[model samples]
Target: MGALLRGLVGLILSSVLVTSALAATAPVGGYTVVKAYPHDTAAFTEGLFYRDGFIFESTGLKGRSFIRKWNLETGVSEQERIVDSRYFGEGVVDWKNRLYALTWTDEIGIIYDIDSFERIGEFSYPGEGWALTRDDKRIMMSDGTSFIRFLDPETLKETGRIEVTDHGVPVRNLNELEWVKGELLANVWQTTRIARIDIKTGNVVGWIELAGLLKDAGVTGTQDDVLNGIAYDAVSDRLFVTGKLWPKLYEIKLAPAN
Candidate 1:
């Protein structure tokens, strides 16, 4: 009887913890979602970057990999280039006057000139590529795991890596990335929450539950179509969000959850 009682108590405690984690919510200090729509529905949007009012996007899938740019205002592809069918394009970032891109499961990252999307060279990685983002100094990458790797932009070498953790647990499946202010904004795949992560310690400072944001937009459905894309426009201080195969991208200003 004692053993059974202990097991039941443990289950009850676990349920409480799960509910608490989901209940801990905070107001977004200063975030406004940018309402923007892409001209085309990208099949697999692996990586996204912005420069000079144009978006540099990388799409996945072995035979359908590509790097392209779209006009921000018109949402029209101004230029596009294709990669070989053997590799899947992943995250993309800007380093100096060049653009760096990664490939899924290929362990190779491609580099190109920023002005012209031309493959200048390639570099090797230790794991599969998932997403890429950068700040003023280091290049940050995710590999579909709990860890985020930092690389040297000039050398493309693993300088160091930080494992993302929620409380004391590893947070896996971190996908699609954007560097906002000094923090790394990560889209936790398959969930309606985006974690604001501190890059130095892998600690999740806070999480923004996007359920209200989506429901407000009338995209009601299951959690399968939850949050995915994250992009920040520093110029206007606007945050843009969307999901996989989503018909429209919304620009929203997050009102703090009081």
Candidate 2:
């Protein structure tokens, strides 16, 4: 059921598409697993990020959508909340102690108190919301398109847009995002690649490829098991990644692609 919705939404998103060939403008990199943690395999991870000592993730697919607050060590949700059935939930991020969650197709975003997970407010946007992340001054959102929208935290209104490209060609299907170091890392939906984008120039500076992490973790499944989530822990400087219905979440150290 969830997989079917995923396929339909994917078709809709891919109707107007861009060729994802990075060519030579970006260098492809690899990874070495630093550590592994448990993740709920049932989660259709659409957004993920690390805050304080926990992982905050949002899952999609109509009635199954959720905002999970996970304890990093045990890979367990210490607290959880279900999104309204009408909305398919997407990305999630934290700003000034507020947790912001986006719903796909519905164009609505929900806000909650970071500590208590209490709903504080909701806002509407113009299109499909796929993923979200943040920089110091603004909230960054992806809408299953090539452009990344910047929203002012207080106003929740779009301030600007960055057309993510690789050598001038638009890169579509920019899924779950994270502000890692100073770069915006975006998942190329249903692929084993992450685009390291330069927000200033809107160019992909590099591509991080993890071809076999799923297989090595014994996460064999259909295309639904693709690489689709990323979360960076700044304080610990650790990078964590997972996928849809994947049992293991990996903390990986970046290395050159072999």
| Candidate achieving the largest TM-score | 2
Q: Worst ten-residue run, lDDT, model 2?
A: 15-24
Task: Show where candidate 2 strays beyond 4 Å.
Answer: 1-22, 220-222
**Tens digits of per-residue lDDT for model 1 on 1-258?**
999999999999999998776565433343455465753455366777677787777777778888888776677788887887889888888888988888988889888887788888999987789889999889999998999999887898899999998775678999989999898989887777777898889988777777655664455536445556677788987777776555556666765643
In candidate 2, list every pair of residues with a backbone clash: none
lDDT of 2: 0.89
Whose lDDT is greatest here?
Answer: 2
- TM-scores for candidates 1 onward, in order: 0.83, 0.89
Say what the RMSD of model 2 is: 9.2
State the lDDT of candidate 2 residue by residue for 153-202, as single tens digits. Answer: 88899999989988878889999999999999999897889999999989
Off by over 4 Å in 1: 1-34, 212-226
Residue 130 displacement (Å), model 1 = 0.4
